[model samples]
Target: MRINSLPLRVRLTLLMAMILSIACFSLMAALIYTARIVYVAPQLVPKVSTSEEMGREPLPVTIPSVPPIPSAPPIPSVPPVLIEQQINFASTGFLCVILIIASGSVLTYRVAGGALKPVTDLSKEIEEIDENNLYRQVQVPPSKDEVSRLSISFNRMIRKLEKSFTAHKHFTANAAHELKTPIAAMLARIEVVQLGGPPSLEEYKEALQDTQCNAERLNILVHDLLRMNADLNVAACVTFSAKELFQSILSELAAEVQSKDIDIEVHLEDIPVYGERNLLHRAFSNILHNAIKYNKPNGSIQITGTRHPDTTRITIADTGIGIPEDQTDKIFEPFYCVDKSRSRELGGNGLGLSITKAVIDKHSGSIQVQSAMGMGTTFEVQLPNASTVY
Candidate 1:
């Protein structure tokens, strides 16, 4: 098998062994070569020979014969024993290197495996988790190492996933429930009209109108759902006058406002904000429609807009039946209404505020509502000013 394809522990062991072997072999070769160069016998110098030994004329002085000094013994050849010893040393070195590699590779494999044990365990723990067990968390190592940090981060990711999954499930359930109600109502009305035998034209008209109303409710609910999930095109954003946006919504709700005899006041400054105009229009329209739908006769509605250095703020206050304190926080939840019967009576599917909040969030803005039961309600919206939109 390819070296890289080996298990991590094996790969690490092999790499370490290879490095050690290279170093040992290099040192051994250098020592062996140096010994061969330096272990030779010392070279001898030739001694001067007498005239008789040279077979030439006698020396001028004719000095008495003296025992010829023996020439230094011919340079001794390297001993066979020494040669054998050198061979033995080289063999021993080679054997030692082989032994070291064997032992070191084993040790390295063990060490590598120990180092990766945490990762192995973490993988097993993660494998045990599934959608039903999303709440489960992997055991975090106490040591502040990468493994510990990884476990912590994984647990955090799991939490976020769990939260998202729960929200999705909740949204789906609510959507189903809301859709089922209108469909059942329509079916019930139709079934009644059919089972009542030959019905009069008035009865037929009444049943048809009821079915149409239910269908309208269904259409509105579906529209809100689609809008909430719609992708906003940031490239399509343009600077628009908030005052004009509110004015247009007010004009659309003029009949409702007049029928309720709700005195309306507009103190809007010409504040320019940047966002999708149609979406913003729908968001404010929902808010204004609620104000008109829930207001008491002769009640007053106040709309105001102001420009800030970085943001534009708009406030809509209406003398309507205010939300209960406990239910205020839940008003933006899909299909949630403080007064379900009243909301249904006013042709509301309880998604207006949810949609409004979604739109504002997409525009990088904030919205807040303050209300006291039976007193009034106020919605404040803040959007990035045109200068800050980019």
Candidate 2:
């Protein structure tokens, strides 16, 4: 593989080793040159006499013998052959040093390459991975070194990515499935109305009404999906009285409340909460509507609001078909319903709880449900007291 494809550590290590080897070889060459210039050349050169008398004849100086005087010994004459030999030896030493440096560089390159083989292989393996194939793991060496730790971390990251991808796939599939049904029903109803038939006026009106209902259900589903996609930053905070908001929502749903024969009981306290008014209204409406829609005939619906020192809690309890224990958490997911058939019969798009969750998140509040399969369901919403805002 190309060098650029190698892992960062391996590439750096190889480059560093190459630079060091070149530096060491350069230093060795410089030392050899300096030694030759400072010591070897001077020692090899012959000395010449400068005096005129010395040029004419050898002056009979009192050159004492070994016992007569302790004078320096006469310099030995350097033969042309000896000079040539010294030159040859120095040339040979220089060649040897060059050869050694070249050999060392080659050896170092090979060793560096060998040491980084595992890292290079690991990089190639990781690069080849995609979402469909995230199960591959690096074959870590048994050395238990830094590479081993790196391999372990890489494996963990792959596992997490796999899980994330799976969840995304599931969400997409579920959302599509939920959206398709109502659309198909609307189309079928319209097709039936378009085909000319000898049905009575009342039958045509009823068919038109059914078509309109399905269309309205589709519209609500689309609107909820859009709201869920709204930017959280744009969800501005506004101070609103919790009791007044609840009362307003209840009053708006008065007709539905009456039709359901659900008795509305409001126990309000003076509690102020800071959040987006419109979003909060949507959340409140969803919970209260759910209470009314799921209640038994003439069941009592209780709405209570209380303020503590730090938080404001609102409870909407209804004697309805309570949720199962296993489905409490999943209820907040988009396109999820406890009873799919019943939800469809009741004209619920299954997006209410999901939108409520998004609104609650914007307010930095929490919502919890307490329910038993046969008893009843109570949804409690808690918001931080406005007095505690920093």
Best by TM-score: 1
TM-score of candidate 2 to 2 decimals: 0.62
TM-score of each: 0.72, 0.62
Prediction 1 TM-score vs. true = 0.72
Compared with the true structure, all predictions reach lDDT values of 0.88, 0.80
Off by over 4 Å in 2: 1-7, 10-125, 134-167, 193-204, 233-235, 259-268, 298-311, 384-390
Error of 2 at 311 (Å): 4.6
RMSD score of candidate 1 (Å): 8.0
- How much is 359 displaced in model 1, in angstroms? 2.4
* Candidate 2 lDDT by residue in tens digits, 1-390: 999998555576667667756776677678767866775677766677756747675557784566665698676666687568667766776676667666766676677778777777788888998766767777777878787788889989878977777767877887787778777887787677778677778878987788787778767777888998776543377667888998889899899899988898888767777777888899999999889888888888888888888888889998988999999988988778899889888878688999998888766789999998767799999987666654
lDDT (Cα) of model 1 = 0.88
**Which candidate has the top score in lDDT?**
1
